[model samples]
Target: MTQAAIPPFHLAFPVHSFAAAREFYGDLLGCPEGRSSADWVDFNFYGHQIVAHLSPDEAGHRATSAVDGDAVPVRHFGVVLSVPQWEALADKLKQADTKFIIEPHIRFKGEVGEQATMFFLDRSGNAVEIKAFANMDSLFAK
Candidate 1:
């Protein structure tokens, strides 16, 4: 059987406030904003659609999991970038004085499928991870 290629996806989630999300995702994360209305907003997050729907009650949920000795968010979203692009983003984050939950660093160093990864939180407290693989194909390698 032929394996189906993985393509980019669209994601939509609830947000407490659009104003806060706009400033955090658009201004801080540098994601370009697209079509929007009073009820929702769209962000071009690394070529994916991330729609923030207005829902104040759903704002405070937080989920976690243990990873690399840290409490990583289980309910989170992020993008996989090319190595150079990932480095560039790390530099930009450093320049912006962003606080990282997991600072950018190499993981599983010298091992098969080693990668560079980092995690940080958005204004609404949503955790986001940005990672790069030495060999892109290793992304799904065991």
Candidate 2:
């Protein structure tokens, strides 16, 4: 399937503070702002609607699962870009001195699902994973 054929999805996640959410989602991630209120803010996250709802008690990732030798955060969200775009974003993140939960690297090398992936957290402690495959068709290969 083509990227354009994938419909945009909506997500509503917790954030500890609106200010932190704004800087992380709006400024750092470069997502454009949408409708918002004092309790929540919406961002165009890579073409999808992701709202950051202020809820201090529910803002952090607390679970993990093993994946390719990494203790991958069980709760995370991100978009899949083309390899070049992913690499560019990785570079930008590195230049900003972003602390990665799992530094960017290719997983499943030489396997059906080989892909470049990385993990990091937003200021609110929400884990986010960004990835890209050498061949998009391999995204769901088994």
Candidate 3:
């Protein structure tokens, strides 16, 4: 589907602390806050719903899958952004000196569905990926 026609999706994930999630997603990631409750908070993550639900005990889990020679988080979450915005965010992350689990760079370069992507861990250890497609049509191209 074309990027503009791609529908947004809702995502709910466990978090160890609401305050920490707030700081990581809201302050650090720059996602705007939305409806919230004591046990859960929502962020408009690139037009997607990312509700961080309180669950301190579930915070310790970590799993990975080898992808493109890197150990990608098996239970991660993230969103696709326009190319320009993605580049801008990459620059911002660089300026902020963000410690990335996978640094911002092109993946599958010169191949179908070529994309720019970066991965980083949140304060609570949740892995997040932010990616972009030079041509939105190439996003799902195969």
Q: Model 1: C-alpha RMSD to truth?
A: 2.6
Q: Is candidate 1 or 3 superior in lDDT?
A: 3
Off by over 4 Å in 1: 1-6
lDDT digits (tens) for residues 69-89 of candidate 3: 778888888888888999998
Question: In candidate 2, how many clashes are counted?
Answer: 0
Please give the lDDT score for candidate 3.
Answer: 0.85
Alpha carbon lDDT of each predicted model? 0.84, 0.93, 0.85
Candidate 3 residue 16 C-alpha distance from true site, Å: 1.2
lDDT of 2 by residue, 4-118 (tens): 5888999999999888888888888799999999889999999999999989999989999999899999999999989999999999899989999999999999998999999
Cα lDDT, model 3, residue 55: 85
2 against 3, candidate with superior TM-score: 2
Candidate 2 deviant stretches above 4 angstroms: 1-4
lDDT of 1 by residue, 9-112 (tens): 89887788888899988997789999999899999998889999998776643777887667777878889888999999999899999899889998878877
Question: Model 1 residue 55 lDDT?
Answer: 82
Clashing pairs in 2: none
Models ranked on TM-score: 2, 3, 1
